[model samples]
Target: MLPKSYFDIFLVILLVPILNLFVYLHNSFSTSLSYLGLPYFIEPDITVDADHVSSSSSPATRRCNIPLSALLLRELLPVVKFSNLVDPPNSCSVCFKDFETEDEIWRLTNCRHIFHRSCLNCWMGYDQKTCPLCRLSLVPHDKEEMYNERLWRLCNNCQL
Candidate 1:
């Protein structure tokens, strides 16, 4: 039988290449994802718990420039069911998804650019105030102040 020292050396020799391959592949994958503007290490999905008042404050949905999403979409540019005539032509600018019949659609008033309802929600969740395609103000001129105020209040969590 081989000595204990020989067995340990053999084991280390076998493991060294495996560990090297792991590190090399990890770095290669991270490099490829970086080119696509994706994070090398992705955070696990975070779900809101009972402790949090809303999902907006949750880490998963936390955005640097948090806007009043509900107010903007629900009260300002309301979602409407997509129909051939009523909806705009072409795919959703935000998510690049095709608009289908019965899909909920949100159309910006100023530029009339259309997007999927959920796509718009996701965009607004990032606190983007302009159209994703044309970079036009999403809110109407008369409601700009009110939208900003709501955004500030919700982001700060204080009445203004």
Candidate 2:
């Protein structure tokens, strides 16, 4: 019943907002999904940005090539019984949960900082290898050599 121009105007008014809303929602969902993945990484020790970032802007540091074998790292972090702790914290730093006698904890050798085993393993699952409290290397300085040697020998990984 409406004139063609009226119909055209009505469709333009309706469809433009719908299209914009669709795009906005799609981007929002994509952003939210991307946001969900960000929390897993506490902080990576190293990052490489190529093509866009020029060498002049950033200092080039030699790669550490640190071995991060989960099995070997676990051996370095000895599990401690809560009741046996010489001076245990009341709660875990990562989860902020109270420690119980039954709860097992892992000690970071370098810093002597302790965390709930589950919390520490979850942190390690994110490829973190630092004491959560002290920000010190989880791998002891002396043991780093042995760790690298064992990893390379066992895994036969090439540096290049």
Candidate 3:
């Protein structure tokens, strides 16, 4: 019969590598699962009808001019600043007038979105709430109404 001490040594030697292998596999599986769990936004290879395109496509593809309320919100959010606005050689979205150094403008903090101050002001005339590019909603001082407004905008934008 094998001595008890020899049996114990053999068991330890055999189990140690197996335990290490199990631990290694567990760590590898956890890393792979984490990667798999991440949200991956990928554009589908198939094309859809033009009508659906506006609703389904990303904000970068949206045809409707940026809303005004979104532009005005810049004054309130620390994310946006007045100095961030720049003079552009491009055309003004509101007047369809070309940009001149004299013309006022603002850039979106998240995406560096540039727009003529007038264009954004005209948009604000209606609602005046979020950033046009990133679409980050601003908190309105009047609680209930602003919250509802923010929720609606988020739903609409997120669906697209």
Among these predicted structures, which one has the highest TM-score? 2
Candidates 2 and 3, the one with greater TM-score:
2
lDDT of 2 by residue, 86-114 (tens): 87789999999999998889877777777
Residue-wise C-alpha lDDT for candidate 1, range 76-148, written one tens digit per residue? 7856777844537878776777888889888778888888878877777776777889999888877878776
Q: Which stretches of candidate 2 lie over 4 Å from their true place?
A: 1-68, 157-160
What tens-digit string does per-residue lDDT give for candidate 3 at 68-108? 23432534333323344444347644566766655557554
Off by over 4 Å in 3: 1-74, 77-89, 131-160
If the candidates were sorted by their lDDT against the true structure, best first, what order would they fall in? 2, 1, 3
Model 1 residue runs over 4 Å out of place are 1-66, 69-74, 152-160
CA RMSD, predictions in order = 10.2, 11.9, 14.0
Looking at candidate 1, what is the lDDT of residue 53?
A: 33
TM-score of each: 0.50, 0.53, 0.31
Better of 2 and 3 by lDDT: 2
Candidates by TM-score, descending order: 2, 1, 3
Clashing pairs in 3: 68-123, 68-124, 69-128, 69-129, 70-130
Displacement of the residue 3 alpha carbon in candidate 1, Å? 30
Report the number of the highest-lDDT candidate: 2
Ten consecutive residues with minimal summed lDDT in candidate 2? 47-56
Report the error of model 3 at residue 47, Å.
50
